[model samples]
Target: MQPINKMKIQFDSKSANEAFARVVVSAFASQLDPTLEELAELKTAVSEAVTNSIIHGYEQMEGIIYMECRLFPESIEVIVRDEGVGIEDIEKARTPTYTSKPELERSGMGFSVMESFMDTLEIQSKVGKGTAIIMTKKFSQQKDRSFSSER
Candidate 1:
């Protein structure tokens, strides 16, 4: 299906931009009129993905983070990408509490949180290239107030 709306943003992978990324994506998704809970979920998932890019993808060095949000009739698709060291094993990285950087106090729950909150989560990475996370969430339709009035 064609996207109703789309937005792309690129910024330095500073730890500061994690919150910025969440807010931007949340604002873009506001067009969908999602419930408060859904909005919160999206924000949290975005935070996880962006944080992973900054911490794991770039290792807190200087790099670029790319974010894209596309709105469909009933869903929103978000992609967060970074050009840094990629995951050697996607499966191992997805495991809960399997942090590769124990020294940094990384929780290793980033992927787990994304998987739990969003309807779908996909990760693409190359050992020397970078990593990209694609996530999609379908919003539930609001109740038809007009139908209640008619009844």
Candidate 2:
């Protein structure tokens, strides 16, 4: 399947940019006419993915984070990639309340939150390389609209 529209951006892995990433992705997803709840969920997922990159991936140091968003008729796919220390155990990272840095008081719910908000979550990583988080969500409200028919 081909995407109707897609965007890619790379930014410094700074904590402030987390909000920027969310706004960019949310705006891109808005074209789908998703409900506010759906949009908020997407933003939240993006927040978690980006925050993870800034905190765990780069260890709060300077690095790069890549974010991509692809839009379809009634769904969106988002990919967040970071070139930092890759996760040692992807499975453990996905577990609820599993924080690699418990000292920081992280709830360790990043993956869990993303999974709950998006329909699917995929994680790929290589030690000393980086990690990529791919997520997808379908817009039920948009599916009901059938904009073509309305036109």
Candidate 3:
């Protein structure tokens, strides 16, 4: 389905940019009229996605991160991508408390947080290429209009 509103951004993959990505995404999601809790969750999810790109994808090396937010009638889709050393095992990476860099003492709950906050999450990656974390969230305050006409 085509999005009613969409926004995309590309920024340096610095740890500092994590907050920038979150605020950008959350601002885009505001058009959906989500509750405060929904907004907070979306921010947290965006933070995790961007951090994963910087921390795991680039391993803190210099890189670029791309983010896209698409708004539908009742939900929003967010995509965070990076071109860096990709994951060897997507399944293992999604597991709770799994950190590729255990020495960093990371909580390793990025994926878990994203999964819990968003309605759905999809990951795409290729070794030596990059990773994309695509997530969608449905706002409880907005009713689904896609199927209403059918009834």
Candidate 4:
């Protein structure tokens, strides 16, 4: 019920860093007693977010990707931020089958996959500035809790 312990990682534009982030974050969350299903979902969501930052945000340019992992006893928080070209419109970006780069064969499902995998997804961006995505998912419970319920 107290504040969660967290760690932040900064990596250069590299595909291997994305994979490492996914594995490390998933493993960190796994220590919280998360189920295998939950772990897989978290990994997928992290991958989508990191891949977006590396490919879309930076556009393969030389930029840094910032990832923060907050480990709570009952939940986890992962924030991926980039100072590359920010999203012009977050709403349009989240739309299914929406890809800015069709030539790259992007499925435009990054936001969708993140939404489906995580309990919550929020994106903040500004043109010529950057984009930051905050994703949070709590540990599974036997009973469903409504929005009005306590965390």
Give the Cα lDDT of each candidate.
Answer: 0.92, 0.94, 0.90, 0.88
Q: Which ten residues in a row have the lowest lDDT in candidate 3?
A: 141-150
Per-residue lDDT, model 1, residue 137, is: 98
Residue pairs with clashing backbones, model 2: none
lDDT for position 93 in model 2: 97
Whole-model lDDT, model 3: 0.90
Taking all chains together, each candidate's TM-score versus the true structure is 0.94, 0.94, 0.92, 0.90
| TM-score, ranked from best to worst | 2, 1, 3, 4
Candidate 2 Cα errors over 4 Å, as ranges:
142-151
Per-residue lDDT of candidate 4, residues 71-98 (tens digit): 8768998999999899998999999999
Better of 3 and 4 by lDDT: 3
The residue-level lDDT of candidate 3 at 52 comes to 90
lDDT score, candidate 2: 0.94
Model 2 TM-score on a 0 to 1 scale: 0.94
Sort order, lDDT high to low? 2, 1, 3, 4
Candidate 4 regions exceeding 4 Å error are 141-151
**Which pairs of residues clash in candidate 3, taking residues 3 or more apart in a chain or in different chains?**
none
Candidate 3: where is the Cα deviation over 4 Å?
142-151
Worst 10 residues of 2 by lDDT: 142-151
